[model samples]
Target chain A: MVTNEQRLACAYLLKVGEPPAPALRSFVSEHGVVAAAEAVRSGEVPDSVATETSARRHIDTAAEDLAAAKSVGARLVTPEDEDWPAWPLLPLTNAAARGLKWASPPLGLWVRGSASLEESLQRAVSVVGARAATSYGEHVAAEMGYGLASRGMTVVSGAAYGIDGAAHKGALNANGRTAAVLACGIDRAYPAGHSTLIDRIAAQGLVLTEYPPGTPPARHRFLVRNRIIAALGAGTVVVEAGQRSGARNTAASAAALGRVLMVVPGPVTSAMSMGCHDLLREGLATSVSSVAEIIESVGLFGEDLVTKPDSAARPTDGLDSEALRVHEALEPRVAHAAERIAEASGVPLSRVRALLPALELTGLAERCESGWRRAKEPV
Target chain B: MVTNEQRLACAYLLKVGEPPAPALRSFVSEHGVVAAAEAVRSGEVPDSVATETSARRHIDTAAEDLAAAKSVGARLVTPEDEDWPAWPLLPLTNAAARGLKWASPPLGLWVRGSASLEESLQRAVSVVGARAATSYGEHVAAEMGYGLASRGMTVVSGAAYGIDGAAHKGALNANGRTAAVLACGIDRAYPAGHSTLIDRIAAQGLVLTEYPPGTPPARHRFLVRNRIIAALGAGTVVVEAGQRSGARNTAASAAALGRVLMVVPGPVTSAMSMGCHDLLREGLATSVSSVAEIIESVGLFGEDLVTKPDSAARPTDGLDSEALRVHEALEPRVAHAAERIAEASGVPLSRVRALLPALELTGLAERCESGWRRAKEPV
Candidate 1:
């Protein structure tokens, strides 16, 4: 069980060090959160750990931070919590273990919603793109969000404007769950314009962040926060991103974390889709056209496979080349002798004679008093 | 030398059997054209060969066909001719040798153009698509044709409406060479709407086909004729295609003939681009957005390679995570001691002290008497 002491230690540690704090994370892992928090408070931790926490270690605000979180209806979910999303964050742990320092798992998450973090993220897919997205891109993103959500999959995004906001709204419109991983504190809406949308998401689904309360959203923090968005989702779809959009950073993080990476194709002329096309051209991402395709790409093996789309079959769909040529030779209005049909089709007389009966059986050709002619249907 | 008798014999063989006639091709390859034609006329050939030519063998229109071709400014370019495009058609021969009967090389091409058949196809790229293409598809196709033609490359396509007509027109607009491989006779234009376009292609470029004079365009012949279009070009670009459009057949033939297959990406909502997307999704074709990409895909080894596109670089593009955090913590108007900066950034005081000097050298930070502050530029 997670004791009050452990929760307090986790809340303190969450704010004491900047995220992706590899050395501090290692120390906490080795010493346990309660003991590690005590050591840091007493200035008795290792130099490497001190480097990560020294600046904030002197200020102990565990009790006040917990109170502030409670005031906003946000709870600190630690590794000791029952809903810590351990499985969804496994890739980050694995990647960090493989020596990617930036992929270190979060110390704790500050979440402002009632849904279980782990449960909400069980089948989540991240849909992200440029803030300057085109109308077409926004349309695709919204449709994909709605489709995936209606199919019982949670849509995850950063809760910013443009593509992200549209995706969140789409999920909400379907009355489906979605999680917004913000770059700012859970109590604060960084864009200001999305304050209501953030509230709706928190009420209906989740509004999560790794930043402590009172911590302002910084430029570098968004990049750091993207790792969480990428890790929480089973797959990442770049709906439409400019060549240097932050979504591309999320995509790269997703790929490095071993998450299924997908890209939606748009007009080659659209500058917003340049990053997506580059990813496809480099063979680093799969091309997904619809929600089903996205699911099929990231779903369990053989579980969510999409069927090959059916193309309308033509009347002469399965005819062999020779039979088709013979059928083409037959005239609809004028019935000609087998010799004339053979000459017109460039098929020998004997083969034409043999093929006529077969063609007639298929209702492609018919016999008249004059000779053989085409059926009413065109070739 | 291509003797008149040899030319006449090839003309008779060309009209005597439907193209892709494996048995007749083998007979002509083993026996000289003159002897093979004589044997076919006398009913002394093998049964297989007889099955291919028996119906038309009695017609004997060699002299009249030759006369008709000359009257329409067309010529019988036999295998014995110097400008037979042997290299361009080598893939058809190779594929046929590998047991692909439909890939049989043509015995003779009926040519109705002033350009040398062999020279015009030396560096050719086939740009083909649906007759019912969208405006966007047509625009891209025309641009590709114009770009390729202006670079001294021949743009090859069928003389149908939509993409084909746009491509041919684009090439002609540049006063560059192009070739039209028709399903019908060289003397006739299959789509009456494109008769003027066909005349222009013949006048300035080349109009070639294997079909004899007076042979009308049949549904099956378009498919049979696609093999030649696939062979004559080093690569084929599908600008746009419906799910079951004839362009898909051309794409298949191109792949079967071992030619580089490329498809232009379009909006997924477009039905005209469905076939191209399917090919891309199935990994059967490369996605090319520009003429440069197409050239890069089909160019010779170590030639015509495209460099990676340039993305705008940010000021902190190469900064490590720690440095970025430290930079973000620095204030623009106020300067504080390194300790304060270290605490805000969650970096060790010593590291912040070190990074400050380095950042100043890069003009990203400014040091005042009070401490360190951000430079005027945004992060």
Candidate 2:
């Protein structure tokens, strides 16, 4: 079933060193791998091209690797494949062109999921932030991941710790789809600690990478990996980051790509949230606190997302009449506790306890450690 | 020496509730007091047509207040006076027009200080914040006030508690000028505790108000007072403020008037600093930390304000070769102790100790509690 010419072209491009892969990708995208091979074979392409010497030698080595790739059941994806993500359709896609110089053009992405890359691309929102995210940041990211995924969007992020892990778990707990894009090969999970999360993502959604099946994650690869996470989503939301955070780099790439960039503002004194504040001040992103705000920014929500059969499970619709009565009892600028709401709603304490859950579930109210107050959009 | 016509115009406008006085100002500017009187007497001016019984009663009552004002040395500053503050030249001056309804325009401002009102206007910078300002806020405000005043700019602020008192004191300690724009009569200082600071500013710079002498500060009057503070300066800097603070109101006025609004950022966790962060995120103001940044924002420099005679006494320009050697020995991006500077300079510790003052005086370096840093600019 394999074409010799395609196999040889793949082999030759993969053998190139360091920058060889990206340059070869550029050559392949502009001219098919067969044409690039002929140019290399005829010595028409420059041999001393910057950082291309390794790429030239990789041709023979790739042939051997291609055999190895086959044995592992991994298939290379080309730009011409039906499964290729159509991100280039976005006007800002040209901004990601900078990623081409560091690594091979992913030799086509290695993907493992039943979901088509095209479909996932159309429905993905990237949720990213610090590996050491605070409990507050974790709560927000989880809520956002669940809220977005419940609306039928695929959550995308690097399979790392903190906010990323929380986002994946939130989606999984909600029985929603989420993809984990890795810096290493599909078979390799960096950090070793997140093996279970990566496995769950592979089982439920997808675990994807540009690297060969066994290639380990490198320091430089993480930076390159961020671009893929950004490109896979229609928008990127940073939950928490510090002044010089890696999340800012992902935001920069998203901004350059002209994707909708959103951020959740945290307490201003937190060093962990300063990057979000900086980005908000720079006008590169909009501040959002709720899933509704994110959905609005991407223009992805309407009757289609909100009016499905699953709408009955939506938090916005789960309120009981008693809860509604209690909410109506409180004035707009006034905060009330559960006791006050119970009294105002003419419900007994026992009944109020039962009603409070319905109010929270309906998103009509929220309970702080102090007491219950009318639920406001996330801030 | 007061003219009857001038007295009458003030009384009538005060009686009529100071209806958007710009047109009246234009009339007064084009014609002398006698001419304005002739127009009013002839019934040519719409404002003079007090046909209703209530309007006529108000005019009579205002005449009594006007008589009382003269006895107390309260003189109105008409818009036409050469001594009038040139606040109208600012971009947001029109936004402050509504504030005119709260008080009568002075025929000419009453004064008690050596500095001319016009000169004060040209150099004014308002420092405002919460009445319950934290020690950190007070410290920052004091530093800003002293620094700006020492550079020959007049500091302006409401004569209230916490930050305001510190700002005025900082200016006074530097033997520099400042203005305390009171919501009440200039004759009485509100917050009784700040009487000493208010008295000092009155003697050294000015204690000004649109309210006639003897009128007590009212809650409503204080709200309107912020506009005058904002209008009188090239910029307004909020040192620290809570979520619903009056300092935020002053910053809003400055922003509406198109004046440079600057805020000092605090630790993101401080509830007191959240207002500043909110303003910064909304692109409503710039964040400033040091006196130099404030001076830069308003286009004032120490060189521009320092007189030749005063420059001689200034600590800058006194650095000896030994001090310069110590400064030069410090590495960029590295914190160097005084001992380290001495070691690196190959100088006796005693000499380095003596030269440290000269180095700081010359602004080539700064001494932090931990160590010294290369001054980004001459301090």
Candidate 3:
């Protein structure tokens, strides 16, 4: 069990510094959570850490914030916890270490479900798209979510309107695990219309966010929140995104974090799919039309290889060019002499003589009273 | 001018050998057409050449064939003719020279239209697809055909129904040049239902084939004829196709001939687009969503580059992450002091004080009685 002291310190740090706070996170890693929290509160931290915490460090709402979270059945999941999802967020940590400031890992996640965040994320895919998505896009996104969740993978998404809501509902309908990474506080529903949907997600799977209690959802928070959604999933599927949507931002983050980025192709005439086509045209993402393709893309090497779709068989599928020519030369009702057939097919008389018997045996041609004719069906 | 003897020799050669007749084509290219024809007629040729011509070599119907063509207003265009599309057919000749037996150039072309074959094919794109195309496929094909033709490029297609017919009609409606390559005699319309459409194309553009007069269109001939469609254009666009459609055969032939292979994207739910999707997944063809993209794929270097699609602009498009957070922290109607805004936004008090004035200058925030509030719009 996590100590109450550590939990309180994490809660204090989480409330004081807005994530992703690279300077404060590193400070806590070096000086432990409790020491860092105390220093931040006393205004005794370094300039870098002070810059991130100075505005709210004096509030000292750790105990009240913890009570507020508990009132809503949420708890702080920190790195000290067993379900921190270290593996999935490693890419973000590494990217931040490489000086991508915006890719810093979140300080802690406030989760409102009983499922283990680490376990739920082990096989997860993020399904994201525009809030103004078309019906076609919504249908595809929901199908993708249901398919992925039914196969024992978690479907992660933002709990907003349009494609995200559709995906979450599809996952919930499958009785499968899903996690909504939100831009607002754990107790608040940003879109208001999706409050019931968000509540259902919290009861059935997980509703997670980095924001402290009572924080309202803001525009900039959505953009910042997208990185968490991208980090928590093994791969990201962009179903339908406009050229300038939040989903594109998540797609960029997924790519930067070295995750598999898959795009579903839609009709070229749709404005909603333009971003996806642009990514495909630029070779930045793979085109995945079916769930099998998605599995094959993100599954372990050679584990989920997709079987080629069956093509309709044709009667003359394996016929050589010359044999095909002879077959074409045969009339369905009229019998032509071997010499006439040879002349029409432009095959040598000897070759035609040899091929006719072979064709007759294969039931592609029939030896009529006069000479030969095409068989209407194989016998 | 092509001499009478050369035209007759080409006519006889076209009738005697079924293309692609590699040995006979090289023979005519080495010895003159007249000499090759005389040798084949007299049975005094090499075994390889004799193998290709032996069936019909003795039946010299050159004069009769010429008369039959004249009755239909068609004439034989030999390699010796001024209008032969030598430049456009160079790839086939080179492939045949490299010992690809299936890629031999045609002996001669039987032309039914007045346009110069070489001139009409100088800037061309072959638009091909399945005879069982969906309406969506037909619409895209027609749009591509009309768009390319309207830009002064010739549209080439087989005169079959569905996508091919739509493409040809689109080009014709634009009052632009187009060419219909046939599997049978130029005088014979293979898909009889399209006789009127074929006649319109011949009247407005060109109807040309490599087969002699009175020859019927056969299954093997359609496959054989596809090479010419792939060769006549600088690139080939597959609008829509089933897995086993002839359009895919043309796409493969275009790839083999080193022509640009482009595919139009359609809905994944549509079976008609599966072949195009497979090509895209396999990276065997480029995805072209617009006519401009098609031109960019085939046009001379940077000459027909496409402009990037414009995205809708947002007011906060240029704001830095911190500035955006500050903007998000300010409520539209409620004013709060700078200290409260700093705490809400988690920005340091000093930084918040500096950024608020900057936000005010940009009209993103306004000074209220208490402190500041978000401006409804930029002033």
Candidate 4:
């Protein structure tokens, strides 16, 4: 029942590590996925096989993975697939790519969710920042995510702590469609603490990755992952970052992808905001203070293709007792020592120290050299 | 038994003003001040006149002031005079007027000090800043003055308070040659508090003014005055300024004159520092942290034109008891309210309020709506 094109397309997706190769994309565009898949299975066309060493290895691995994918309910969504994300391919599909050099061509993405990837990609925007973000940064990023999502745009961001989690939560709180792009496989969340949030995302939006199922997240992979986030969105906004933060990497990727790069400025005295100031001074990025500016900069207004989602009601689930105890001890603008936090939270010093680690891992607190500081600003 | 040439030259100095007109400059360059004055007085050459109304009035006025000047201790110094500020004419004489457009063509400068104007101009650099300056600003300006002057350059400034007075005092304290370009008449120190400082400058270096001996300082004249400050030096540096401070006006003059413009940066949270920050951001001025940067920026390294005087034991003779009292109360980084200052200094509140007016007039203190702050850093 499978056609020659479908077989070739399947082989192409299997050959590439993640996100299918550009040639495969071209193949899917020119011939249907079924015909491409058929060509790959029959070895009917010489061009169907990958020519480069890396591509060949990727293809061989993908072939093995594709065979195993069906058993795990995993499916390869090619550009020809009705469920494929159409929005991310806008750049690849547009005339802008005619004469540009790509730093890295994304293979077709592996995503899990019932929400349409193609529909979400049409209005997706990535808001990224430092993992150890300040309250000022989180507030700005949250506002941006809420505003953009309310305007019918799908909020896209890495599901990491600090600004990223705030951005995702902001969208979810607004009842807007959102996606979390991860470094690890979609099947396994890396941080372990954000499992509940990730599960929520999977229930409502989508969890996407270039890594195959069960692949653990590596530090190096996050850099490569950032490029996909940049390529997938119309623009990237850096909410807060230090001079050497990873958020700057995302901004650089956005620049390379010919996507708009925006940064939020903060008080100059704050060491954390220096990167944004440096970018503004160097004229590499424009300053964005509000979500309206982001939307205007990305030119996402007045588009009828994207539909706005209804707002989500507040979750009835409250913070656990330990979390509540820790939260109650936090004060704005004050750096609390771990011992002090333990004393104020009314928990044993050993237990409080352990809880502090968990709090940091979950993005509720930041570990400074002197002490642990409350990460989130109180609403 | 003054010769016709001498009378004509004296007349030209009186008629055309202390700084010569552009056309008069050309005429003086071609025929010497004496011949140009004769041509003007005799109406033999109307083509060289810059403005008919001004030239005729100047001719009549100069003929009288020339006679009166001879009665006094002052004497006319024409461009041809060995005592004239020869260094300022180097740009014009060398025909490098492209960047020096902001410089007025000096017909001649009147001299009062024992030192030669020509020799001093060869080593001059202007240090200017906000009249309502902060302590940090004054500190920087003073250091620059002393540092640059000690390195064999004459300190040139407007002699107004906060930074300018500090600069002049810094140069004076270092026993280096210094000049004060006044907006008012040289004989009348408009800000009466600086009478002692002006007198010292008149005795040691020179107190020069474009306006006649009795003209009071006018708001409109300062703009033209700033141009002379920009022109007379190899470069100008703004230490601090508010958004629309007159220091910015001086910087514009320096830029127009093609003089090197340098600015010192401060904490961005301070509103007074923002003007300098804006200039640095706009690339209108280079940010300089140390005195060496100023020296190198103006190319003052190679030539040993002006000799450094013995400044090791220079007396702090000019500061009066009242000025010293106000200066002693100023502390770096702390801005105190008038009541607090009065309490701390053991001065009556009424006396403190009264002293603020005098201090502000002398450029020692700046009045804010909240309180009085030190205009310049205390030495």
Candidate 5:
């Protein structure tokens, strides 16, 4: 349970403090919120600490803002909250990913809507791409989103226009659970045109953010928020990204975190799909075109899905050099007796006869009344 | 050495013989075509050999066909000719490729065009694909073909419709050297519709086929001819192929022959590109979108070509755990003193200060009046 002091201190920190700061979190973690607050009030805090005039003045308002959150029917989920996600473990992964510089698990998240953040993220899949997506990209993204949602997986996205909007709509159209992780406050919609859609999402799904209420969306905030979406999902799918998409950052973070990274293939000609094609070519992500495929990739020991068969069935690859030499020696469209074949191939007659039937079995040779003719192609 | 007996004997063998046959070739090779024909006429040939009446009845016609070929301005290049393509050495690569059974070096080629068979193929790329290719596939094929030819590289292809025709036209449009390896006689146009195109290829480039003149195109002939396309070029690029395209056969042959195999990616939505996509996903072919990229892949000491710059320039990949944690601890858009970051991140103040400057050098963190904040995604 959060104490009155802990509540007030958290509220104060949330109101005026810049986040992810080591000093403030350490001070709060080491000492109870009450002690930290008292230290700030007495101007006796560590020299590294910044108890700015605005944060001091906002002390009284922290209580009121906490009440406002309740009034709005939203909950502030802290690290101590039972419902907190496991993404706080990212620091360990990011140590290897080197993504820690710009990517961090949120200190806390303010979530709204009836769905539980815990439940929503348990089996989540993120679908992200360019804001300027092509119809081909959008269509593929929507199908993937809908398919993933219909399979009982929560779909997560940033809720921007183009691919993001299409993904959200596809998930919603399937009447499936979805989550929108925003850079701005959960109380506001950054893309004004998406206000209604955001409301719909909040009504049926969940709206989550690390920013406090009234925080406006900023460029860096969005970059920071992308990690949240990636970390919350079981895997991240890049439906379509341009050469310089912010979605690429999300992919990197997921990859760094050892999260399953998948990509949808699009026309190589479309600029929107260039990032996807490049990722696939560079071997950074596996290619998946359908929900089943995506699930197969992220699913635990997913062996139910079948792989595409190799188009190559040439048994010609099985022939020994001597047999191949004899096979190659036999004429196309012309039959050759064993003696003739042996003479032409420089292999002995016994060896030529020994090789002919085996080559015939591999479909590289055919028997005719005159002798044996080479198949149109070797095995 | 145009011996009359050798000419008549070669004509007879060419007229009725199945190719790549060891015994007949050995008979011709060991004692010359004259001896082989004389043995056939005298019933002294190997027991496995067939001395049928029909071939003997056509004996008089053999000399006539040879005379006719000369009259029409064509040369029949035999294995004995110094101008045979290096493909005769395919057995060496095929030994490694395990392609001996279905693959063979051609016996001889009837050349109808003036271009040197050996020189034309020294530096060549084969662009071949489905006969029923989509407009997009054809478009890409044409561009690749034109680009390759414009770069002074010869383009080789089977002279079929769709991609093949487009490839030929693309080369011709650029007034570049091109070669068409046909299934039928060089004098016979199979598609009939491509008679003019075939003529243009023969006129501006070369028309070569392994089949003797007067032979007609057959289903198996096309299949057998595909290998020549693969062997004639330094590499083979599949512009588009359906799941069951014969182009896949050529790609397999190319792989078997150790030729560089490449594919031009198309929209995954199109079935015509499925084979190409599958090959790419299966790691069977490298993807190339333009002539420059194709050349880069096949060029000697190709690694000298510059690599594409990584979009993620964040030197975060270089930071250690302690530095990464401190870097991650610093808030985005907000700076903090070293002491503050140390406290929050659980590192000592001195260590935090030490890590900060290095992180700053890596462009993962930056110093500000407030202290330090993350650098906006490094260079």
Candidate 6:
């Protein structure tokens, strides 16, 4: 657990370090916060990556930063805090975290809101998309947010223009909780038109940020902040993202972490729905279009009920004759390697290697160390 | 094999009998066409429901219909012919055909086109939907038809107004092969405005129908004709069906027959797209938009590649703690009835019956005479 001083010091480091400085941020995690802070204070390079001069700029200003944060009614949450969203915050884990990507999970979060952070995010779903979403996309996002929020699942977003703005407003209008995980400092956030939206969000649910007071928004910050929006929610839904929208980053994070990733399909001709099509086509996400569908993807009720069978979800149902022939070769008890499984299955070896993972992902084949065991589920 | 006399007789029967007359058709298949024609002539009810006098209506006018069909450059194909679309016409099997509901496989098909009935339909895809389709729906259907046609797959439709017209027109415009599976007889099919369009389809590809040369189009005939559209294609894609459109029957036939079924989703606000959404929600079809996606659902390429996995397809991936507990209680080897499985699974009987099919469809379990057995596909 981090001490109050160490927590405050970590807050100071957040202000000085470049946003999404994975290397330095990782160093703090690797070397204890105090030791890492001491290195920065003593003007010693914390690692080969940090220069002595740059390290000095990271000196502790915890006292000042903490006071500034409190002055605005913000509360600091560290990894050790009870309010921290642990499960969805998986990008912080060593193996899951991506390298120098535009998006990364935050070291600590600053929040201000009436709702309890713990409860607000426990069943949260991130509804995000292009800032310039069309009216159709906005309507979908709003409906999704309202529907999900009304079901008691908080809606999380960047609180940007278009889909995000609509989603936040929907949740607020429904008298349901929502959270805005910002790209800038909670105090320094801008695009002034969203001030009312953000303020309502802070009052109704939460306004969260990784940056300390006075940090300016940058191109990379929003990209980096996308990970937080993804990590804070139980699932991430792209309502109407463009092909290159930052919401795609959140989608990637959600997929990598095995979150329920869904995309609301729109008109195939719309530029706004392109990312959604790409995601659906690539099998990165499944298409969902309503609040009930959104719940089916991320809520607890999904687990308790045995829903109707989805043939699309079972790609195994579509296997070619050869692949299906190969799949039938392995025994449930035997852990057959690729060559043996191929021989047993009467399919060529190259095809088995490729077919096994498809089977594995479809929950058909198990990838033991020996490899290629038929999944014991009934065929 | 259908002798020339028997063929002509069947044509006469098609003109008089209610289309899809599954009972009378099955009688012919069972008793042989000559005997069935003899029975119709003797005015002796061939089966229970065939009243003596009403049965006499099913006489052989094969000679007359054949001459009329030839006059319009049409060729009649029967189940006995090599040109027949056989495999997808599963309703011909004794136990498989459902009682008259919407549509069923045809007793015979009339064809008029340059393309071979066998080859053109080998990779055909039915693109169908609402007659009152929106511009968006029509545009999508057209593009999908054109793209699929360009990829060398035959585009099949009823050639109605809106989506179906657009789909056929798109395929015709691309100079690609297309088939119009009409509800009426080939020579009497067109709805005035679509006459030239129908002519072009007949010239370029095929204008086919189960109705004999002079039968008029009727509501029930269209409903029955939808089964042929479903049966004749490798897959069916509903572009913009209304909630009660005949396209829904094709979708249902496609699903029940275990054919690849896809629906192109449009704006949720569009009532035409509602049927698509309902189909998708009910797991009756996967949502698709483009030719590539359409092909992905129907073509063999999907099985060879390790496409990224779809999370929605794996609803079991999100089992709640209680659900997980219930699932884990069942033994892998046991084939337990619903009540027994419930006892073993520690789930309530009602939930067990509900969950079992979902599990069975997911390939996690198998439904047997005794009850549910653990699926052997593998854990």
Candidate 2 lDDT for residue A39: 70
Candidate 3 chain A worst ten-residue window by lDDT = A299-308
Error of 6 at A51 (Å): 9.9
All candidates: TM-score: 0.96, 0.61, 0.96, 0.51, 0.74, 0.70
Name the best candidate (by DockQ).
3
Q: Docking quality tier of candidate 2?
A: incorrect
Question: Where does model 4 exceed 4 Å of error?
Answer: A1-78, A81-102, A110-181, A185-209, A212-215, A229-243, A259-379, B1-31, B35-217, B226-379
Preferred candidate (TM-score higher): 4 or 5:
5
Residue B95 lDDT (model 4): 35
What C-alpha lDDT, on a 0 to 100 scale, does residue A211 get in candidate 2? Answer: 62
lDDT of 6 by residue, A245-313 (tens): 688988987787667788887887888887886787667786676777677767567553324333233
Native-referenced Cα lDDT, model 3: 0.89
Candidate 4 per-residue lDDT, tens place, A1-379, comes to: 5443454455454443233244554654566665655554454544433321122332334555555554444555654567666667565455234733233344455676778888888877889999889887788788888988888888888988988888988888888888898887666775788888887777778888766655557544676688778877898888888877778888887876778888775554456676675566556776655576677668777553322233343221245654555655655457788667654443445666777777766666777777777786434
**Mind giving the per-residue lDDT tens digits that candidate 3 earns over A1-379?**
6788889899888888988799998899899888888899999989999989999998877788888999999989989999999998999899999988788898888999999889999999999998999998899888888998998989999998888998998899889889999998998987999999998999999999989998888887888899988888888999899877899999999999998898888888898988888788878888888888888888733677888777766677778888888998999999999999999999999999999999998888999889999998753
Name the docking class for model 6: incorrect
Writing each residue's lDDT as its tens digit, candidate 5 over B1-379 gives: 4556665666666655544334454556667667777776665777544522122322345666666667666677765556767553454335433536346455467787788878777788999999999999888888888988888888999889999999999999999989998887766886899999998998888888766677666555676688788887788999999988889999998887778898877776788888887787677888776677678767733653636546654556566655665777788899998877765554556778788888887677889888998888733
- For A119-184, candidate 5 gives per-residue lDDT tens digits of 678888989999999998888878877888888888899989888888888899899988898887
Q: Which regions in candidate 1 have their CA more than 4 angstroms from the true location?
A: A301-303, B301-303
Backbone clash tally for model 2? Answer: 23
Query: For residues A1-379, what per-residue lDDT tens digits would candidate 2 score against the true structure?
Result: 4466775675455444232244555666678877876675555665333224322342355555556555544556555567767553333235427453432235556676667777776878999998888887888899988988888889998878888899988888888899887877666777699987887777788777766555556545676677777767789999888766678888887776677898777654466776776677567887665676678777775633322122123333344544444555444456666666554443434556777666677666677766776677444
Reference-based lDDT, residue A293, model 4: 61
Question: Local error of candidate 2 at A63, Å?
Answer: 8.5
Worst 10 residues of 2 chain A by lDDT: A303-312
Pick by DockQ: 1 or 3, better one:
3
